[model samples]
Target: MKEIYSNTQRAILWLGDYSDTAVPSHPNAVLSRGEVKAAFGIAEDLAADRHHDTPEDREIAEGYRALDALLKVPWWQRIWTVQEALLPKHAVLRYGDTEMPFARFWKAFDHYFAQSYRECCGEYWLDFTDTSSNVISCLQTAIDYRRLLSHDQGLVFSVLISTFRGRLATDPRDKIFGLSGLAGTLVADYSLQPKDVFMRAIRTTITDSGSLAPLLRTPEPDRAKDLPTWAPDCCAKLGPEAQHSWDMVWFGLFAAFDAAMGTKAAMLNPSAGPVLPLQGLLVDEIYEVVVHGICRDRDEFCAMARRWQHTTETVAKRNHGVYPRGGTYKDAFWRTMVGDMILHEFDAQGTGQSRRAKASDEANCRMLWNPNGDHSMGVPFSRDRQFFTTRAGLIGIGNPGPKVGDAIYVLLGGRVPFILRPTPKKQDGATLLEYVSPAYVHGIMDGEVMKEKREPSWVHLI
Candidate 1:
C-alpha cells in the first residue's frame, strides 16, 4: 500500500511538473478574431465549389454552405452577437462610462450587423421576406456555426444531446432524430460540461424517485414527458437564441468532463479489468470530481451541488442493479488520493508557489468565462490579489473533510474544475495522507482508459 501510494504521488508531481512546463507554450491558444474570420472565409470558399465530384467534398460543401448562412444572419438576430453588442453598454452602465441609452446600443448593433453581413456574405437587405430561403439558410447557418465554433468535444456532446432531446420531443422520425441526436450528444458530450449542463438538465427534468418509473411506463418517444416539471421551465427560460448558444457551449463542457474523467480514472486503477459498465461509472465520477473542484471557487455552491446531484442521478440511471455496482467507491478512492496530494502541494508551497499556481488557474477560468471580463461576480476569488491570497491559504494542510469532498464533488459535477475532493478512507475511516509525502510517486502503471466512447446504457437504466 505504501509503495503504491508513493508511486502515485511521484507520478502526480511529475505530471504537475510537465503541465507547468508545457501548458504555457501550448500551440492551440484561443483563436484570434482574424484567425476566426480567415477560417470562416476558407470554409466558405470551399463550400461555394458545388462541383465537388466526391461525397466528402459534397459534405464539406454542405458544411460551408451552412456556415455562410449563419454568417448572413444579422448580428442582432443572434443571441451571442447581441450579447457582445450589449457588453460595452452594460460596462458603461456599470462603470459610469458616458451613459449610453439602450436605443444607441441597438443602433450600434444594427450598424455592426449590416457591416458584418456585407463582409461575410455580400448582402445588405434588412427584411427576411426579400430573401427567398432565409429560414432554411439561417438554420443551416446556425448548424454550420455550431459545427465550426464547437472546437471543444464536450460542448459538442451537450449540443448533440440537446438536439436529440429536442427531436425526441418534437420530431417524428426516430432514426433521423436518433442519428442526429447521437451526433449532437457525442459532440456536446465531448465539447461541453455534461454535468454542468445536460446532467443538470436531466436531473432538473427528472427526479430521484420518479426517474425510472416513467421510463418503464412509457414508450421511447414519450419518455421525455416523464421528465420533472423543472425541465421544460428551465429549457424555456434559456430562450431560443440562448438555447442555440448553450448547445455549443454545453458540448464543449461535456467533452472536457469526459476527457478529464477518463484520464484520471485510467490513472487510478490500471487493472480494473474490462468491466465496461464500471468503467462508465468511474468516468462519471471523475467528471463529478472535476466539477466539484471548479465550483468550490464559486459562491454559487448550491447551484453546483444541484448539478452534482443531477450528474450522479444521470450516471446511476435510476437502475437499482447498476446503482449498487461499486465503481463509484473506487472512484471515491482515487479522488481522495489525488485530491489530498493537490491540497498538500498547495499547502506546502509558499506565497510564490500559490501566486504562480493561481495565475494559471485564473487564466483557465477567464478562458472559460470568455467574453465576460467581469464574470466572476459570485466566485470566491475573482481578482488576482484575492485569488493569490485565497489559493495560498487553501493549499495549507488541514482536515480534508467537507471542504475537500465538496470541492471534489463540484469539480467532478460542476461547470468548472476549481474544487478538490476529500481524502480517502483508511482502515479506521480516517482520511489517508500517504500520497502527499514528497517522495510519493504517481501515474498509471497500467490500464487503457476508455477514450471518447458514448454509452447509452445510462439512458436505458434511467
Candidate 2:
C-alpha cells in the first residue's frame, strides 16, 4: 500500500513539473492550426460582449483580425506568420498571449490548454489527485497546490512542515503528515512563503465556515412554541442508537473544526494582534451554539434546517446576477443543506417520511432559496415563508416560523408527492402502477413562485 501510494504521488509530482515546463515565456512561437482557431474563437466571443464596442474593443478587434488572417494561411506559412507577428519589434509583444506574438513553443502551451486532458492523462488518475473525503483533507490539499503555490502562506507552511515532520513516523496520523510535506514542497516550488500559503488556507477555511456560522448563531424566539411542534415524532421509530449516531456525525464536524484551530493558529504570526480572528471566532461560536443551544432542545434539529434556509436566502440575495454569479454558492448551499437535512430528517422521522415529505421539502426548499428566477426578480420573503411552512408540514420536518428550516431542513415536513396512475390491463396479467421522481418538477415550481413574487432586481444586492 505504501509503495503504491508513493508511486502515485510521484507521478502526480512529475505531471506538475511537466505542466510547468510546458509553459513558454513567449506568447506566440509556433501554434498548431487548432490553437490559432481556439484563440480566435475566444477573441470573437469576447468581441461579441456588449463592452467590446469601445475604442479599446476596436483595438482588440484589430488584433484578433490579424490573428485570424494568420490562421487562414497555409500550415507552414501560418506558423512563420504568427512568429513574425509576435516578434519583439512589434509594440504588442508585451501582451503575450493577450495581444502579443508568441513563438512556436508558446503556441504549443496554448494548444495544451485547449486539448481534453482526460484523453491524454486518464480520468481515473485525475480523480484520485482531486478527491476530497473530509474538510481537513481538502484544506490540506488546497493549501499545498492552490494556496501555497497560487497565493501566500510563508509562516503557515513552515509551521505545518515542522509539526508534520515531528510527528511519530509510524503513527496512523503520519498520512496527514505526509500530505503536509507534499503541500509544503509544492508551495516552496511555487515561490510562495510558508506564511503566505497557510494564511490563504486559513482564509479559505474561514470563508466557508462563515456561511454556516451565521445560521448556527441565530436564536429561536420561544423554545416551547417551536420545539414540540417541529421535532419529529419518529425518533422512537428509528431507535435511539441511530438517532445518537446521526447527532454525533452532525456535531462531529463542528468538533473537528475546533480541534483544527490550534494547529491553524500555530501557523499565524504570534506577534500579530487580533484585528479579527474571524475564522477561529466563527468556528468556536458555531460549536458553542450547536452543542449548548441547539443540541440540548428537541427543536434543535428543526432549528438547524431553518438556519440553512436563512443563510441560503441571505447568500442568494447578495448574488442575484447583474454581476455574474459563480456556481460555488449554490453548490455549497445545496451540499450542506441537503446532507444535513437528509440525515437529520432520517433521525427525526425514521424511514416512513424519508421518500416523500422529505424529498418534497428538499425540492421546495431549493425552489424558495433560488435567487435567479426567470422573471429576473427576487422572490418575496412573504411567499417564501408560506412555502417553508407548507413544505415543512408536508415533509414532516416541522411547522413554519421565521426561524424554521433555517438550520434543520429547509422544507421540514413538506415534500411533494408523485402518485402513480394505474396502467391499462395487459393481456398477460393484471396491470400495475409505477411512480417516478422527475428532476425538473421542483425547479419549475420554484420558477413560477419567483415570477409571482416579482421583486426588483439589482446588481451588488448581496
* Top-TM-score candidate index: 1
Q: Give per-model TM-scores.
A: 0.26, 0.19
lDDT, residue 257, candidate 2: 23
TM-score of 1: 0.26
lDDT of 1 by residue, 385-447 (tens): 001001111111111111222321111122222222223534234332211000000111111
- The C-alpha RMSD in Å for every predicted model, in order, reads 23.1, 23.9
Candidate 2 stretches with Cα past 4 Å from truth are 1-30, 33-38, 41-45, 48-269, 272-462
Query: What TM-score does structure 2 among the candidates reach?
Result: 0.19
lDDT score, candidate 1, position 311: 44
Off by over 4 Å in 1: 1-158, 164-239, 257-461
